[model samples]
Target: MSEANIDIQLLDDVMNKTVVSVEESKEKIFEIAENAHKENNFITLELETLRNEIDLVITQTDELEWKAKQARQRLANISRGFKRYSELEIREAYEMASQMQIQLSLSRDKEKHLRERRDELERRHRNILNTIEKSENLISQMGIVLNYLQGDLRKVGIALESAHHHQLLGIQIIQAQEEERKRVARDIHDGPAQSMANVALRSEIVEKMLNQNRIDEAKVELRLLKELTRASLVDVRKIIFDLRPMALDDLGLTPTLRKYLEEYEKRHHIETKLTLLSPERRLQSSIEVAVFRLIQESLNNTAKHANAKQVEVKLEFKPNKVLFMVADNGIGFEKQAKGERPQFGIMGMQERVKLLQGTMKIESKPGKGTILFFGIPLRIEENTKAGGSEK
Candidate 1:
């Protein structure tokens, strides 16, 4: 085999081993969570039984106290009238009082023991619940890792092969892709996953409340759960829009940009204006997506690092090219080597424009706002001409 083939084979072997290791770990965690859940259920039932036993013991003790009081009174009366009562009567009365007192003491002790057991069980149940939650979260994270390895990360080999001449750029792209995946995973876990878990728990609570005939409380819980579901839906939709705005395909670029900027201004509390120098028209899908991303990234930078109060965007469509500009009145900094978090956005924007065979320019300085401009060549539609090409 050639050296490249050998290298590819080695990468495959390494990935397979890594995946196996992760899968094994995930299985172990799942097993642990299941066991913990079972243990919690058992503890719950035990606690219920213990509480009932304690209640019974309390009733018995209360009755014993009354009987012991009567026995004491009878013994005292017999003792006071020693000449009128037989010795057997007095002795019997005294014994009865002593026995009643002993029974009361024993009953009270039983109640105490049952209560302690109930408390212990409750503590164990809570700990088991926490364990189950942690184990479940770990399992979910491992699944994300497995998906990344088996799905998108697999593209690394193809990227390396295709960009052999640009190894560093390929690696940077891979890193960016990995970071994006991590971010998406984090957002899902924190937003939708947590909301769904709460929804499940709340639904269970509502069911229990209704079963117990707590109509008012169940209504309140149901309302809260509905709100949570709504919030989760909104979060899910926002994440989807971030990934790819469907409106870009349906309504074209101008409406999409206008809607996006208006929402952005509302969300970030920044002023934004959009001016179209030429009438809106559909470009190629690739160009549309690229341009949208460029604007999106610029606005994100402005929000995160620019501390901008107002931003303006301009778009101009010509016969053979499109022009775009974003100017922000924010705190800008001196440009230097790109190695920081703030610089990563700019770097990504530049790479995106480069992929579209476009030119991008950035002008910024300390105490000055930032302005970004782009000129992207438009490609003729294949259906429009037999030899359609980029202009």
Candidate 2:
């Protein structure tokens, strides 16, 4: 064959292979995007169902709260009139109080479970949306290359590079998700699950006392049960809020952060100070969530690893951007190379900032404390500004 013919055949072979690889990559991405869209829809329906369940539980809780309050008042009145009442009347009063206490405790537990379910559903929904966005972006980038290449030899190299980048991103996302799942599972086992088990054991003890005709002892057990249940309810609510703070939706970012830091300090026994430099204003929902998670992860890391006595967080709102910093006075460690074993918390924070087209920097030394700084541009919509003013 002529040299020209040989060259043309070689070029044709390369083009065919490149086109095949591009098509396969496109198909894979489209599959991912479609699955993500379906998951998003499923999560939306689940969230709606969860919200209805939560509303119902809230109504029931309110009723129980009222009834419990009334029962307590009746018990107090009975105590004052005990000298004038018969033995049966006093026993009946105590019995009524015990029943009311048990009922209220059960109702509160149910409400707590419902709220946790709702929060988990919401988190899943956010994750699905993120996956969809990433898949769509990858597909769009490939389309641009496909349009511009027109069978060029370099198309193969570019397509391969794109595919590799997408693969790495997918791995990173999966790793982050797994890490999150582990954290949540650990928290549930240690916090609410343990609390619930204790409640069950106490309830059993109360039942045994009542069966043995130890009315007075049973009454005391009931009282202890009430306190334990109330405390457990608080713990469960805190877990749910940490999973996804409702204040982030109702009160906006600044208020939510302030409230969270206050709780964090009390819980961790680490003095935490928050400074807000901007006039309290709301940002887009996505940005608000990202910023909240960034700070949350930062403080969590500090609590677990820093052993610091105090941590400082600051937020500054700019005309077209927002900046955040989390600093801790604790034993620091050597910074590892980016390619080293991943620090999941730090990596997750970096990924969140990257998604917002923002910048993140971490500074640490063996003796000095660690500092994390991130900034992201904000597009202040008219409606957002108006909403801020209302707040």
Candidate 3:
């Protein structure tokens, strides 16, 4: 062949190889993007599921805690009645206390296991999120390269953009998860752990009193120990409930909110009222949880920052949506002031509403109290079944 013909043949061969390589790269990038998306979604679901499990375990711990208190109270009463009561009664009290102690041990073990599982799931979630970010970055780079090639690379660019958006969302979710985990850890350390330490000290006091042959004093000390145990159990249950309320699952939203509000009022001495304009109907589990957490966080803020005494929570069901409003008669801050921006709690609530494809509004002034309104779209199918059972 002539030299010119040979040059043309060589050019054609090079072009063919380049085309093949580009096709292969495109395929690989698409595969990675698909897999990363799937993995990220799976991780998100798994994290949510893990959270639910943790909530259930915490609730069980709370019940066991209450049972422990009852046992302690019985034991204390029996000790008081020993001088005037039957041997059978005393024996029964001891048996009850022993059973309660065993139950308490099992509950603590379950809680520990749940915490470990939460940590593991959190770590896995973080790793998957990081992987998604890297995968998106690689896809973006591939998109840039594909732009220089011939024929229909726009789809790859779109895919790259979509992946980037998902990666950002994943990052946001991970940040929220981390914040929640930190909050829970702080609560456990400050509330339950401290209370437990106090209980231990009280128990030691009772032991020393008995050792000194002070039966009457030891009885008094034991009474004190019983009270301390009850209080500690309450603290632990509050911590656990704050993490997740089983009532949200068992009693649906309205009853759960009522119970929480009642408890909140009793705890903070803040007069609270819950008004339900909508018929008692169940919502999607995710929606129920989000609404519950939103209200919980809002009330917590009210209790902590709001100097007001009365809080009102309202739930309304519309034809195609559900609306939640938490109005607190507190010293509301300036919603528009640059120095008075929304805090993490408010932002977290907003994030949750957004996840449900909802809109949230906060209305507050310096002294007019604060009112938060958020509306979430609801599908007709979501109102299908009620939750498990009433708490």
Which candidate's TM-score is highest?
1
TM-score, structure 1 vs. true: 0.55
Best by lDDT: 1
Clashing pairs in 2: none
Q: Model 3: per-residue lDDT, tens digit, 1-391?
A: 5885676567556656776787687678668766865665555556666677778888988988899899899889878767877888888888888998898898889879878877987787688767755665565545444433332322333345575565556555655665576577667756765566556555665786688988998898778778777877887888788878898888888999988888888889999998888686777887888888888888989999989899999999765678989999899987566776568788788777776789999889989999989898875566433322221
Sorted on lDDT, highest at the top, how do the candidates line up? 1, 2, 3
Model 3 residue runs over 4 Å out of place are 1-161, 204-221, 339-341, 379-391
> In model 1, which runs have C-alpha deviations exceeding 4 angstroms?
1-163, 166-176, 204-215, 305-307, 318-321, 333-344, 365-367, 377-391
Weakest lDDT window of 10 consecutive positions for candidate 2: 147-156
Q: How accurate is candidate 2 locally (lDDT)?
A: 0.79
For candidate 2, report its TM-score.
0.49
What C-alpha lDDT, on a 0 to 100 scale, does residue 389 get in candidate 2? 64
| Alpha carbon deviation, residue 344, candidate 3 (Å) | 3.1
TM-score, cand. 3: 0.53
